[model samples]
Target: MSETFSDDLIASLPVLRRFALSLCKRGDLADDLVQITAERAFKSRDSYDPATRLDAWLFRILRNAWIDMTRRQKTQGSQIDVVDNPELISIDGRDVVESKISLNQTEEALTNLPDDQRAVLLLVCVEGLSYAEAADTLDVPKGTIMSRLARGRVALAKQLGIKS
Candidate 1:
């Protein structure tokens, strides 16, 4: 890989971490997922096409890694520990209490969603991916992405006690 490609990969770390955290819902697990994804991306560097979006490719790789990890955990009959760290809070304003409450509510609602719905919601709504881009990344049809996003939004709204 060239210096530019390496830089691009490095630049995608924050977004990759965010996506992994959204999927795994644990800081430690998300960190491991990101590390594994970086290793895989480096090993498969030659397989990457420069013309394609690097972030999208990385997202796909990370998603696949998370899926594999989940399957392995299921087969092993192992449970993942949920870390109760307050650092996961996303604060948007000066009211710390309100921010924490809202963040917790949103996070809880998100985690309650089915994996497929959560994945699509995070990619399209949170990560700002277009429907077509998300479909390509997930290897699904655009219509599937749309339907999942719709269902996810409605479900999330209901969870948050908001009328859709």
Candidate 2:
């Protein structure tokens, strides 16, 4: 790969990791997904179109990788082990506890959303991808993206007890 490609891949890591974590909900698995994405992107560098946005291309790769990982996990009958998160368990102070609780509540609300809505929320809202870009990354129509995002925002607001 050329230096520019390498630089782009490295620059995309933080967003990739965030997106992976949103999909998998485990730091370790998210890291693995990011690694797999980078590897695949590097090996398939020749297939990338230079005219398109690299971040969207990488997001597409990461989303596909997560799908592939989930399919394999299903075939292998894999399940994530649930345990209390340490941040939520902390008793440092009232402020810290409140902050953790608020954060956890938001995350849990996001988690409860349907897979399609959750993916749309993360891609468009959290990752700052335009509707068209998100649609292209997910290989869906722009109308679909807009609809999902609208529904997701309403659902998320309802989950958080916010009037919309």
Candidate 3:
């Protein structure tokens, strides 16, 4: 790989992990997904088109890997909770706790969304992909992406008790 391509791949890691976490919900699983995505991207670099965005290509690969993985394993009902770390505690303990609580609530709400809607929301809203890019990444039509995004926004707002 060229140095620039290698650096771009490295820079994309954090965003890749965020999207992986949204898909898998478990940190370890998300890490594995990111690893698989990087490996696949490296091995398939010759197939990449310079015309398209690298990040979008990587997202498509990660989503495919997640699909393949789910087909191989059965998901359990047990959910893992984030353990409190003392290092995170601040001088204003109440404020820290409130922030953590709010974050957890938002995560829980996201976890409750249907997979398609959540994926659409994360790609467009969280990852800052344009609707057409999101559609291409997800292998769906642009109109489908738009409708899913609208429904997802409405559903998420309702869940968070935000007026829409």
Candidates in order, TM-scores: namely 0.48, 0.48, 0.45
Q: How accurate is candidate 3 locally (lDDT)?
A: 0.88
Compose the digit string of candidate 3's lDDT tens values, residues 20-130. 999999999999999999999998898988789999999999998888677445433344443645565448889889999988988899999999999999998777666
Question: lDDT of model 2 at residue 97?
Answer: 84
> Listing every candidate in turn, what is its Cα RMSD in Å to the true structure after a full C-alpha superposition?
14.1, 13.3, 13.4
Taking all chains together, the TM-score of candidate 3 against the true structure is 0.45
Q: Per-residue alpha-carbon lDDT of model 1 for 13-119, expressed as tens digits? A: 99999999999999999999999999999988999998999999999999988986785565567444446655655665778878789989999999999999999
Model 2 per-residue lDDT tens digits across residues 85-126: 444454569889899999899899999999999999998776
Better of 1 and 3 by TM-score: 1
**Of the pair 1 and 2, which is ahead by lDDT?**
1
Between candidates 1 and 3, name the one with more favorable lDDT.
Answer: 1
**Would you list the clashing residue pairs of candidate 1?**
none
lDDT of each: 0.89, 0.88, 0.88
CA error at residue 97 for candidate 2, angstroms: 55
Candidate 1 lDDT: 0.89
On the 0 to 100 scale, the lDDT of residue 124 in model 2 is: 75
